[model samples]
Target: MSSVRRLRPVWADATPDPAGRPVQLSLDELGTPLAEVTFVVVDLETTGGTPAECAITEIGAVKVRGGEVLGEFQTLVDPGGPVPAFIQVLTGITTTMLIGAPPIEEVLPSFLEFSRGTVLVAHNAPFDVGFLKAAAARTGHAWPGNKVVDTVRLARRVVTRDEAPNHKLSTLANLFHATVTPNHRALSDARATVDVLHALLSRLAPLGITHLEDLATATDPVPEDVRRKRTLADGLPDGPGVYLFRGPGDEVLYVGTSTTSLRQRVRSYFTSAEKRGRMIEMVRVAQRVDPIPCATPLEARVRELRLIAAHSPRYNRRSRFPERMPWVRLTSEPYPRLSVVREVKAGDGATYIGPFSSAATAQLAVEALHETFPIRQCTRKLPLVAAPGASACVLVEMGKCGAPCTGHQGPGAYAEVVDRVRHAMVADAAPVVEAHADRIAWLVAQERFEEAATVRDRLGGFLRGASRAQRFAPLATCAELVAARRSDDGGWELVLVRFGRLAGTARVDRRTDPRPAIATLQSTGEQVEPGVAPATAAHPEETDLILAWLGKPGVRLVAVDVPWACPVRSAEGLGDPATAVAALVRPRLAPDDGAPVVRLPGAGTERELDIAEARPVTLELDDARVIPFSIRPPRTA
Candidate 1:
């Protein structure tokens, strides 16, 4: 995207203009007079409320300029099927009447011709306009670039509750004393709306809104204080960045970012497009907008996260809370068992898999792992050597637990279970997936579909959380890595990451070599310390944003301080956890063609697993595919 040079806010101390240059204003400032602008009052009758599935049965429009009718256009369209009885009663246009009429293909071009070069006016603009635009897309016609006005919004701005109980078309048409009444027919409602439009414009005339362009502010009338504060957005750069609306005493009121243009995004807060009531309150109290421009979209997103975290602005509620989700951790102790916790400390030497949405999900995932490895489920800590005279629980008698806490199972035997649990968390997941597959089949054979589904979901959540942690581990472990991708503007977008945190970013023009830029980035980048998990080093959301950008098609690694690799890589293409589990259970992960399957007590027997029954191996993100996107000049394979 193109960018404008950053300058001081409009309310800042006045700077004298350059001697020869004259001030230029946008067309919006000196707008076209309302009397000179032509408007097409339109309404539509459709088979249903949804535009995507429903077909338009009729179109009605009346073109007017300076309170005088110029022409009228009306058509009954064949919607290619029988109209529902409810719609027939509401519209009074029967399926029999539509059978002999022209289809949308024949009627649309004529309607477009009649309403060309005029502003569109409708009671509820989105409803009427949505159907028209959907029709255009369905019939291979380009939608027109006409401005639209919603009379309902106009009445809500100007009409008082005492004079009109509601802003509906019938209420407004009767209040304005129109010659026609709205009866849900296309042409009748269109003519009634024309009278309502004239009355609403007259009310707006005294508010200094005499031009067509000024109608935007009047339709959903902006408070005068908020309107004057639009100057706060002036001189903001039209580039990707974070913008903070600061209140009195220099406290940040809200923080927002735009991947396209900071200027446009900040400016929108003062317009009708920003409908949130709290945001409007934030804008009203806002004294200034501070724009923090960055080299790439990834940097802008990271900066936004950091600002929201630091300030905890009242209006920014979406991400105001810290990332405190639960993670299923393998405790680093004598007899390792699964435990769920929020905080992660570096160098713990325990397998960590999650950042699950809730503690319940983390616990369910833990149970799935326990189904394969008979790890202890008790919460109390166990010593290196079990306590003397400790009694074993019934779980040991049931063969569900090794009862390491009571010394019945030695540390050496418990160590074997811990290793397999670690491997399932960090490496291959076929073992856990296979164990659940056998139970699900047995449950289904017993006609227990709900239990089978529960088993399926538990396995899905476990693999997904495990896969996600494995995905972030490689990037979190690497101390320093620099990558680059071809920017949309034919330039290089350089990204510098340290221990999974976005350390720095830079943009190089098409004509410049990025090597020097990369060198400067390394020196200027944010210094970070690597942590045991990605969340320990940085916010999980921030890591997710950086990973998403880096994993895109054009991204290439320029250099790395160490080898970066993950064990639980995708076998098929990118997909959700449910699909991943299905592939693992059915045909994808079956033991065939020399593939090893662990022989467990409850898991399937050593039956010859059909190789063809397995899902095709996941979309490879291994070295063979990743090497192509890596442009590091001197790296050993």
Candidate 2:
């Protein structure tokens, strides 16, 4: 079928270029009087549900500025097909009525011209906007990207469900005593929607939503009580900082940091657009906003982590349970055993591996290590003299332990095994990884597929945990480090890191030299001893926080007091474990020339699989005998 011909406008056009015209006002100018803003409320009656299968039967719209109607546009369009019986009965538009009407090709261009330079409003807007975009595409016209607001969503925020049974246009119209009643005809519905729009906007005025941009996010869930606290942000300085919301009892409710203006970020919580229910509740209960200004964004982030750790705020989820975080440590005994601990004690003489997210992950890493080396897994205090009646554990009988508790294994032999475990946890994980690879291969060959997969996942998890521990270990050992990043405003953000904690931070303006500021901060910073307990030094969470910031774009390592490096070769070479596992479990597809295909569970249709381009296979572990070794580029400073 030939495409429909494009039609040029016959009327004199005075519309400006939508792209060149400025729509967003500056934050300072956002208080522009709402009466000057224009709105175009639109409604459409369609033949079906979605744009692809539907055609618009009629269009109706009204333009208003500041609550007063300026103009109206209405039209009937011929869909060029028989109207469905149900649609005709619902819309009262039959094939006979549309016989003499103009086609959509003529109706759409005029409607676009009428609605130009105005924010479009509709009840559940996506349906009308989708149909308009589809009609424009079919008729060879570019769909103008216009700002839109949904009245249904707005009504839900302004009028509570208890006040109005539902947010339907008719229900809202009756509840608000609208000027026009909705009867489902295009014009009546559009007019009713306009009334609903005004009612919602009137309610929004008290909530400090006067700007056009504010209308778009008005449906966000801010409680009525929280809206009154908008003045809490009145005198906050516009800079990078951490903000704490305090409850009535002076307890911290939530903690957050912003690189932009602290005033702007905290003020957003009082608006209807803040939709996180937990945050909304936190804001509602908050009696004051406490702003802790920082010299740089990095400092703000570090302070936020420290504050969250200190207060363990009810609304702060992460970095709040540092005491509960698991640490993988070797016990201090004649025959040391690996154990997951909640705290690292002073003078334990034990080599520590992690402050892992959970005990389960730390235990998994320990189990993977035990599988490779015959280490003592029993918990006992073995002395130079053995107990008279002590017997070996079952693990020792099964050849999994060295029986060090019963003195069957000498200190020299057990010491060698302990050294191997320490090396695997600290420097190299190759031995454990190779052992797991061999076991997985043997299981696969014996047709024990499930067991093989389980062992493979365990090995992956251990490698990931070990690699992470190694990356952060240097921070704990370093005496001092200095890092810098170029801020968006052309300033240098200098970070003074002592051991693993952020000691100090300062922002050096581009107009001035940064050397003096950096030197001053570094000289006055706190001294941190290597391998100190977290209670005495900076929390482990601070190290992770700094590492994450250093990984972001525009950050650079300017200087370091000591050298640091990640391993050049290790299990990290296998790449991300999740990605590797996904490749193994993903269903394979047969050749596409109408061959019968067996559908695997969770796999897409055969056509979808056929259309997908083949990805180059990397580190595939299908052959159990092949061990993948990764040579990573060493990161040094």
Candidate 3:
């Protein structure tokens, strides 16, 4: 592509590019002076503070520009209901006073028109604006998306406790010596608030806040030294990407991603829109920003996770230590037992199940498996055949384990039990679901609803973990998978995913052919070898992110080497155990090209499945000398 057609970041300034495209600049790039800005001080009286539950009874506003009052708008509204006694006493506006007033439907149009294209000002902005917004919604009127400022917030920043005891409109009115005294009526309070706004602006004037943008952030708790760091936001790409905030000596202080303009999002940290104390502190020590531009928002988010994990910046709390996420591993030893581990080795030869949400949830899933199949509860490394003098544990007495240590079960017999769990981890969870179904239904029939619900949750966790593992395994070993999605800008966002990792990405302009872009992507994309199954070459969380992107609406699969297939019958959606058992054994639709076959344990039938779509797959569990550990089915129907 020529330079004129090359993709440019959205935040590039309006200076015409080689293509002569006329680009418009964002507000922060070209600021408006406060003297030229219109501010409307508004106040409202309502039945209550809850906007959703309350009704607006009155509205008052004064429009000013350059400290000169241009106009005043006032209206009394019939709220369509009686005013509460407490509210009537508080504002001195009764139901009788509102009887002949125009309804909010009549008043909203005039008020919206009067406040159009101006910065809204109020005592407590959310309280006043919230009422108007709620009224607009209730009356089906379009509310203007205007800038808002609260005089109370402004006073807190500009006026100290030495100037006033509290930052209230009434208290500030007394301090500022307003021309009009606030008597709790709408117009009177609005006029007083206008005076307070002017007084606060006068105090800020000495600090050189003469622009609307400066006024917008003047009330933020950010210190002046930190505010001076706003220049760090300049020169970042104007499109979706990850941004790193660097402290002195170039240590990364924070990692963030923006699907919108990187400059715009980075600039927000220096303004009032960013209110987190930790972030404000991060911005304080930050000296510069580094941009990592991406072709798609999904790639940006995935890279954000990877960077957070790689850097483990002190400021980023989550995704900093994904390695700490626990996984339930069915150990590969002779007497295999399920174990919760924080790490996975590629050649361990052990079957793995999850990087579960939490260690607790992973343990619950293990217990669910143990409850259904007597895999083993012992952590001891038992020999293939038990020694003559080896002893068994209490669980063996409880029939929860086939004690391989004492030769009660041989490796062949033990493997049968372990195989059932292995199946649940990677293939089919039908056995686990079927195992829990009868006990759960029996408990429900016995009026033990809580017990049944516990089993249900445990079963759900195991199913989710297993299904997640199954879903991630296919893409893990796939050498390459190229896909594309439509971008919001009428362009195409192309991605090169390798072993579940984002190897390369490109965003094409809508007017350009995406074929050349895709060709460039596949040739220049990072080269990655397939990693172990389940996790593949990328982190499970990262794979989850990629899968999410692939699964989004309008994602087109350009090419792939691996056949994407999962079990058509998942471990969910059955009303009862019998139904689940029946659902598990039913023959699934199979691809004509010879997919894998699953032999249902005890069902005495083999079923083939279609792997074209990679749905959920299941397996049957076989336990020798099975003793009922579950609540035995009740005698009742």
Candidate 4:
């Protein structure tokens, strides 16, 4: 394809190639600015194809400033309804997954905050960027107007087409020999893209793609005004509430919120003559401005929280310790028990709190509630286990106990205390809702229709929030119970549960076996029984060699372990010294022309599959079983 036809003229000043076709530049030829530009690597998993037609299921993006990882943001969005089965499987996001998640209206703001003030980077820029634009348009916010770098195009420029058979993310990962953890997860994939960027940069270093601005402009154009606006946003409100700035091309220079009056505060940046230069420059980039009026101070606080958590404006601070936050999770048992744990273990049950840093912090909170509510912390499993003869133990001796452990307190009485403790933990929501409802009722009775309508809105918001919290509590617990990323003596392990049952586990094995094969190789260079069919006239070799032994007997899982040593001295010049083998047995293998058949453990049936895709292939019967296989790539010179 010609360069002119490949490049789309999306910008006003975009010039066509010499042939009047779109131009597609390679990494080596494309201009990159090393200084004065920041890049935001982004990825998103959604409900359907088009952003207008579907909703975002998950979003993960990282900001890079000065070629270093400056910040990151990731969240599982509540797309608000059932996600298709294929999408759920592809993204690992289920309909049950986002039940109580905050809606897009709230989530978009947090996303913006992370993406603000930088050029976007993605594998296929049009796909991700288009979706984002559509999402912004759907919401009340203006579509994001920023430059984007498509890594797919960059990869094509960095190496010969033959070097990478297909330019998929997986293929590039293999080419770079990149170590990507949690492969399908949004964060892990984004990290891999970043690595690819660095590798491509090294290859294209001589192409004048070194500077930040040059690279940014080379990939996509950024109007000069957007830069000035960002410069002047430095003094704006740091509190939670919305702020809107207009720029060129219906450009939403920034959509954000501050905990304080960000608008009044932002304008103060232009009060001085010296600051006017920067303010004027920002205004030149922007075209309009607006703000939504907030009712209560608490509502303002929450709105700011929603915006920061959503838009992640350029000036907003990145999350300090998102995974360290505490959350409550319900155990996957007959009677679900709540326990406190950290966000890193979000998929684990046992309601979490603090993601609070220390046990003392969590304990202090429990104690504060205990002082007011008199709730028992003792185990209900063996209520009398605490004391030998007495009805109650030391807890009763102290003023802190309601004495439920010994049955001294009835279930009804204990329940009341438990309710109070729960309130202390999350703060009571009922009272707030009831108060708002009461105010609305008074307004209605007084016939103040407009005021009543306003009060009704407040009440509706509170009720809706309560409903979401209830739904989320259960769904969050379910997710926690069904999946978990754990660490064992061997290495890392991922557990998958089904309907609260431990279904399977995927683990990495670091050990390798050393042995040689006693299995036979046919005279015509294939593994088969003698005289089953007419043999080939030519035979490459009849020698016997051994390969590694690996297995995962617990589940339909894939486990790969690097081979310890080469099985044969003759198979040396094949490139990688360590070989890999994989095995999958199900639904019996179909008849094929050249595939080798491997017998099942019980001699029940046979299965045919690729040796390369198999992690463990059975070719021998020894304890340190070694499978004989060729390590040669067919000669084509």
* Residue 329 in model 2: lDDT: 79
lDDT winner between 2 and 4, please give it. 2
176-287 per-residue lDDT for model 2 (tens digits): 7787899878988988887777667767666666556456556765565776676677667778899999999999989999987787788788776577889988877888
- Worst lDDT run of 10 residues, candidate 1, spans 626-635
- lDDT per residue for candidate 1 within 236-325, as digits (tens), equals 887899999999989999988899888767767766777899999998888999999987889999999999998999889755545567
Evaluated at residue 519, the lDDT of candidate 1 is: 98
lDDT of all predictions: 0.74, 0.72, 0.74, 0.45
TM-score of each: 0.63, 0.66, 0.65, 0.30
Q: Residue 624 in model 3: shift from native, Å?
A: 40
Measured on C-alpha atoms, candidate 2 has an lDDT of: 0.72
* Order of candidate numbers by TM-score, starting with the best: 2, 3, 1, 4
Off by over 4 Å in 1: 1-143, 149-218, 221-231, 320-323, 441-457, 533-536, 568-575, 587-637
Candidate 2 Cα RMSD (Å): 10.3
1-637 per-residue lDDT for model 3 (tens digits): 0011122212222234355543322223424546558888899999988988888998888887655577888888898899999989999999999988998888888888888899999999999998888888888987889999988888877788887789988898888778788988988898888778777776665554545767887877666776667767656777889999998989988999998778767877877688888998999888889999976788788889899888889999876666777778888898888888886678889887777888888888888888888777878787775688988888887778877878888889888888877876676677777667666535533545567667766776777677777777778878899999998879998988898788988888899999998999999999998776777687778888888888899999998988876666544333333344334433334323343334332323222222223432222223221111222352211
- What digit string (tens of lDDT, one per residue) describes model 4 on residues 313-362? 44344343334434333333322234444532323323322223344444
Runs in model 2 lying further than 4 Å from the true structure: 1-118, 122-128, 139-145, 150-200, 211-214, 217-240, 258-281, 293-297, 331-334, 345-348, 384-391, 441-461, 488-492, 507-517, 520-536, 570-637
**Model 4 CA deviation exceeding 4 Å by range:** 1-32, 216-637
